[model samples]
Structure formats: C-alpha cells, structure tokens
Target: MDDPIYDIELEDCPICRGAGLIQDEQGWSVSVACMDCGAETAHAEYRTPEERLEAARRVALLWNMGKVVHTGMSD
Candidate 1:
C-alpha cells in the first residue's frame, strides 16, 4: 500500500539533524518523529482518508517549522 504520508517532505531532526519518520498509530493518527534524537511533533488525529493525509501533512509542516518535542536529548 502506498501511503501519501511518504510523499510529504520532512525536515531533519531539530535536535540531532537525523532522519525524520512519519509514524501512525492504528491508522487513527499521525506524527513525525526523529530517527536519532527522538524529537516528535504533536499527534494529528484523523477519522477518514482525507483526514489522514491532512494529518500527515500537518505534522510534516510542524516538523519543518521546527515545532517538535524533544524527549530524548537536552536542547
């Protein structure tokens, strides 16, 4: 299956400059997380396919804007 979230461009981790990943929980919500420092954006919940895409986009935007929560490392 091709998830549209994968099509969205994401910025590197604000804390570690590592790769970012789009993660979903049980197909209901999405968030962007850093692969190295574990920084993440707030979860965007969705109820439909359109919402899912929008949620993905929202998180990606937040990530690119450097609005992320770093829980693994000190800033």
Candidate 2:
C-alpha cells in the first residue's frame, strides 16, 4: 500500500532546522511537528478526509510561518 498523502507543504523547523511532519490524531485532528526539535503547531480539528487534508494544510501553513510552539525539548 502506498502511504497516504496530505498534499501539504511545510518549512524546516525554526528551532532545529529539521524536517516537518504532518500528524493526525486518530482521524480527529491534524498538526505539523518538527522531526528533530519537536516543535508543533496548534491542532486543527476535522471530520471528513477532505477536512483532514485541509487541516493538515492549515497546520503546514502555521509551521511555515514559524507559528509553532517549541516544546523546550530542543533546549
């Protein structure tokens, strides 16, 4: 099976310059997180798959804008 794609674009982590990942919580909500720094954007809730994709995009936008919350783990 192929990996599901969200078609979202994200920027590198502002804290650690690492990759960003789009994450979903049991199909309920979506957010973007840094792979190395653990910085994350605010969660966006969704219902359908379309909404989930949109939510993923929303978080990606936040991540690109450097609007994520640093978890302090990078420090």
Candidate 3:
C-alpha cells in the first residue's frame, strides 16, 4: 500500500494556517503567496488524508459534470 499523504510533516502557515488558499488585495491565490509558507506545507492541525481525498473527489465530480454539460463528451 502507498504511504499516507498526511503522514508528511506539516508546517503551519503563520499567515493563513494552511488554508491552501488565501485572500488579499489581489483576491484569492494559492498558499505560495506567503513568503513564510512554502508549497506542500501542510497544517499542523488540518484535515486527514482521507478527508482531503474525499474533497478532491467531490471537486472532480463537479468538474466532470460541468464538462459534460458545456463541452459534451470527448473522444
């Protein structure tokens, strides 16, 4: 079996606490905006791997739905 994704160490974002997305004067952006926060920096206290996977699955489902409705099926 593959290792757990969340098993990796998680560094807390001093600015957003690892929200993975932050809002500023320029609007929303990835966590990369924060100089103090680096990519792959997970939250010390955040969702588990299972939770993240579930969320991702839901998003993918929505994306597929939109694609089917607007673009139709691709070959």
Candidate 4:
C-alpha cells in the first residue's frame, strides 16, 4: 500500500523537527512528560485565513483520494 500524502500545510514540530516525539522537562511542581512533539505553546501560531483555506483545499484532495482507494479495494 502507498503512504498517505501529506500535501497540506503543516507547522513544524518545535521540539523534534518532524521526528514526532520529544522529551519533557523535569523539576516542576506539576510537570507532565512530553509524549509528542506537537504540543501547543504560547509562541506557536497558525496560518492566516487565506493560507488555511489553501490547506483545506489540499486536505480535501487527499481525503477524496483516500475514498477512491477504499472503494476500489472493496469493489
């Protein structure tokens, strides 16, 4: 099977840089372990409205491609 194409705009993972996981800091009173690299941060932000719309279009294209693959295999 082919891998799913990630054609949409995606923010880079700050901790792992697309490695998908990261280590957490210690010594805090209520500290939590970082299991994933894509945790939301105060400095992190999203794209603008127009950029988001373009990303939506790309996502739709990929979703339709997935549906085609599903139906083709089931038939």
- Say which candidate scores most in lDDT: 1
Tens-digit lDDT track of model 2 for 1-75: 343434556678977889988887887998988878788999999998777777787888888999989885545
TM-score of each candidate? 0.92, 0.86, 0.29, 0.28
lDDT of each: 0.92, 0.81, 0.30, 0.29
Candidate 4: minimum summed lDDT over ten consecutive residues — where? 25-34
Residue-by-residue lDDT tens digits, candidate 1, 2-74: 7778999988887788999999989899999998888999999999999999999999999999999988866
Candidate 1 has its poorest 10 consecutive residues by lDDT at 66-75
By lDDT, rank the candidates, best first: 1, 2, 3, 4
Q: What ranges in model 3 sit over 4 Å off?
A: 1-46, 67-75
Question: On residues 1-75, what C-alpha lDDT tens digit does candidate 4 reach at each position?
Answer: 331223333433433333211112231111111134333221111255454444344433433332111111121
Clashing pairs in 4: none
TM match of model 4 to true structure: 0.28
| TM-score between candidate 3 and the true structure | 0.29
**Which lDDT tens digits does candidate 3 get at residues 30-55?**
11122333322212222555654444
Count the clashes in each prediction: 0, 0, 0, 0
Error of 3 at 7 (Å): 19
